[model samples]
Target: MGMTRLLRQPFSHPALPSVSFASRTIIVTGANVGLGHAAAAHFVRLGATRVIATCRSESKCAATLAGIEEAAGRKGVVQVWELDYSSYASVQAFCARADAELDRLDAVVLNAGVATRIYEVAEEDESSLTVNVVSTTLLAALLLPVLRRSADRFSSENNLTVISSEVHQWAKFPERDEANIFGSMSDPKTKTMAERYPASKLLQVFAIREIAARTHDSTPFVTVNMVSPGLNKTSLTRSTKGLEAAVIKIVNALLAWEPDVGARTLVHGVVAGRASHGVLLDHCELENDALAPWIETDEGRRLQRKVWAELERKLEAIRPGCVAAMEGKEA
Candidate 1:
């Protein structure tokens, strides 16, 4: 992006679908706070018939939903569901319920993410890798049936959007034959703490490419894309402490966009057309070069293939026919 465009990003129109969402259903993960909270409110205000807000716990959603309800007044309908990315079971349960209950699913925004400096591991993987990459990828694939069903039935371009970040540009490409990138990040000897969060986001962009490739021939109508909210004053930095937290607050005050403004980019990702499939939707425009440079060479293709192969195996083990359902377009 040029300096002029970057400077005006916060003011860019979200380019939300001109089409109405009156009868459409939307799902937003991690809706209790951050960009997801703002996005859920946007969808409600835009006339979506139902906005499913997936919170970590039921009690956590009261405030966010109340705010959204107030913003939409009599025009919004919101529902809260539990989704814990640390557990495979929680993801599966949410997907199953969505399939069984929702009549016409339209959009899904995978905005629930974490940026952690700590190397704590959960589900035997680094927390950032588990939540940002693995679990996010798993949920996207599992939810494909519902998204595709909506596209076919409504003849509308329903989207599955994964929230990524500009920080993804900061990661170094993985070397050939590196088995587990997450494990490498957990090792201080091999990892730089500063780059760990970006590395996880890099996986999200790659995963979006891989999925777009997989479903391209089979399910071409449902748009799948990645979006960046730029930097926003959100809970993503709550884990920082003392000097670090103080520095982040200062940076946010000076450089970060408001959560509601950033949320517009998330909405653009949800309604973008098929031309945006497999690409980064930066500043609400389809970007061809926002992906890693390696993706342009044979090495990047090998890397994407290898990483996605492993992800497929891992997610399939937990959800049984989940990955296959993506190809078959079953609901």
Candidate 2:
């Protein structure tokens, strides 16, 4: 994002319309706190029939639900489920439960993600890449049938939104040229944390664009989109320390939107019409321009297809038959 846009975000975004979600069932990952927590509460306050809030720990459920209910001034609508994006097994298990249990799944906000300056590995890859790109897309794929079924069954507009970031525009993504893009990303010897989070978000944009295009039909069923909630005051920077944390704090204080305000962008993504399909929703509207300029170039398109292929291969290795099953429904 440009300096002008970043500084204007907290001040210029207008109030979102109060749209009711009555009779809708929604899911939000990373709902224990931050934008996810606030978004879950907003769904409840808007009269959603149920909000399946997912966190990394079961122990956090009670307090998380309590806080959401308290914030909404409503209770019993939000239920916290356990999910660990670091584990493919956890992501699959959560989707399995959603498939088996929910009668009507209205929307899913894949908000669970991490931001770190450390070079830690999780699920056999760089931690941020695994959680933010691989597992997030995996969960989105695994939930496809459930969202489609809900649309077919209830004749409703069901959506799946992955929380993205405007920071993606800043990612140079030098690894895009590597023969094995993900392999290059996972290499600690070449990996750099300075742009890791932004690159991961860029990968998300690539994956979602491909997923949305592949899933598109004359009459679409489940609406799929990504949202950049703008810069928000969240614990996403909790891992940074000392001078880095201090700098971030100062920047956020000057520019970050309140979590609830930022989360309205997520809620807007869900309610956004089929027009939002295969696109980035920013500031509560379809934002094709928010994408990096290179994304429209020929090389960027090729890399997007490559990223989707690699991501599908990774998900299939983690859970056999999943990619094929999701593809079977595309046409």
Candidate 3:
């Protein structure tokens, strides 16, 4: 069956008028499920010319594609691409393929991530940092040209929206001993998996800010911003069982919103609107107070520089060509 025929429900928003994606091309990572899937479906439904629903496996993407097409009311509107964020080689390969297939990328939602799992290292010497932070940083660097191309074609509103989380508030500044993000996992005194997950998310916020700053002066039209989706029910939370689930249920009932509702901020960040470059948004609203204190800190800048340098070194080791492509080139 074709994909569009399967979608039956249209996304609803009482506050903001429904927006369409006609003629735009959006790349949604981890699009096989959860907020990624919802965002992909919403874009296709709004008339996006091309929606790349990227996932780690094609076989696993079938249901997502089907659901997206159904939601969009068209066949073949959503296309699946393989992207294993944990593998530097895979990330490079995906970029090469994306460059060939797409002349422009209107928006790239870096939505793929992991949580509540055992510590693991990606291809690069970095821990899961390679996957969650390094890979995302490199991908944006590589795709800036395409995003700029799209901005040239569109108005000044085109942007790159990064999916971040509120967990960023809890991240510790990168320390000498914690260079390897997973190093703490080995410590018996380490905090829970939930805490570690939030720390990684915090790194992403800094990465987004750095990328935004790097690109703003040159390509003001192509803004970059971070979006924090408040807690929602998704596969990432599947690890919650028994008492954990009960606690989550209670907490969610009090604070968490639906997946589509949570995705609103990301969607708003990408669409033409009042959003500013280098800003962090929460629930479709700019987070001035939340991000202001961190951005003003010397510690934040130091951590940003350290992480950026380390990621650059790791990427170069894994894919010299990609590093060379982004070197000295203004995104």
Candidate 4:
């Protein structure tokens, strides 16, 4: 099928007949608001059997769940799962619960992330590397067994789609300094939030490729792809100040699509026509030549491997049993 045809098939819009999800299950992280919430609601409307809308707090997730249920005319079909991406224990706990309760997870939307106002270290010296990189990496690793089991139980084709950003093009990898990455910076030029945010996202793209490379030989049906939503008016962008906010607001008003529109590309990445096992996509299609430089770089790959190694060390320190458990299961 053509790319456009595949991308448009799963989501036809509210006026059209919703897609059937009689047996499919989906998990969307950070579903409490913004893109995650929109994606979860869309999945529910499409008739997904179960849509796990995960958030760090149950109370914060209430409104999102209520709105989705109201729109879908169902209650139990859409449930809440508490997941704090910053905490390794929380990530493990959520994965364990999912393994026990859910029959299978057809799709996992790795959408949760943090764009901090200031550089802050996590449990380790990992700042952006921790929340954006390590947390996501560990979550995917922890859930891989369940994802594989689900793929086996449910047909064969399963999907893992991570939400990356177009801004990743501006950052340099491999040369990142852990001290500067999470260090205290008083200078505006040295501590720009956009730079840090994009760097973390770049890491995610490489991680996606690494994951695809590792899994492709054994699991051809489990497609791993990265999705860039473009610039949408989500909570992530709501805090911009001065001319920056004004410029973004105007641009978003003129060209920025809705959260649902942005999410269309992500959903398509998961269920669309054949996507390259390790490709990075923007707005439902592979990014053009202009965006290729950011994703394809020896430096990027080196940085990704380094980040993975550092993450493994940190996880081994905090969650001693997790790495061993995941390795044994995948073995």
Clashing pairs in 2: none
Specify the highest-lDDT model's number: 2
Q: After superposition, how far is residue 95 of candidate 1 from its true place, in Å?
A: 0.7
Cα lDDT listed for each candidate: 0.79, 0.87, 0.68, 0.69
Clashes found in each candidate (C-alpha, N, C closer than 3 A): 0, 0, 8, 0
Summing lDDT over every window of 10 consecutive residues in candidate 2, give the lowest-scoring window. Answer: 322-331
- Please give the lDDT score at residue 159 for candidate 1: 88
Candidate 1 per-residue lDDT over residues 110-194, each given as its tens digit: 9998887877676867778788888999899888878888778887778899998866877764533567765666565765656
Model 2 per-residue lDDT tens digits across residues 1-331? 6677787887787476499999999999999999999999999999999999988998998999999999899987888899999998898899999999999899999998999999989988999999999999899888887888788889888899989987898888898878888889999899978899999999999988888887786233778899988888999989999998999899999888888898898999998888998888778867546778888899889888888888888987888877655553432
Residue range 59-162, candidate 4, lDDT tens digits: 77788789778766777888888998877778889988988998878888889887755656565544566778778877777676677788777665777778
Total clashes for model 1: 0
C-alpha lDDT of residue 256 in model 4: 57
Once fitted onto the true fold, the runs of candidate 1 whose alpha carbons sit more than 4 angstroms away are 1-19, 173-177, 186-191, 329-331
Looking at model 1, which ten-residue stretch has the lowest summed lDDT? Answer: 1-10
Give the TM-score (vs. native) of candidate 1: 0.91
Error of 4 at 40 (Å): 0.8
Model 3 poorest 10 in a row by lDDT: 1-10
In Å, residue 3's CA in model 4 sits off its true spot by 23
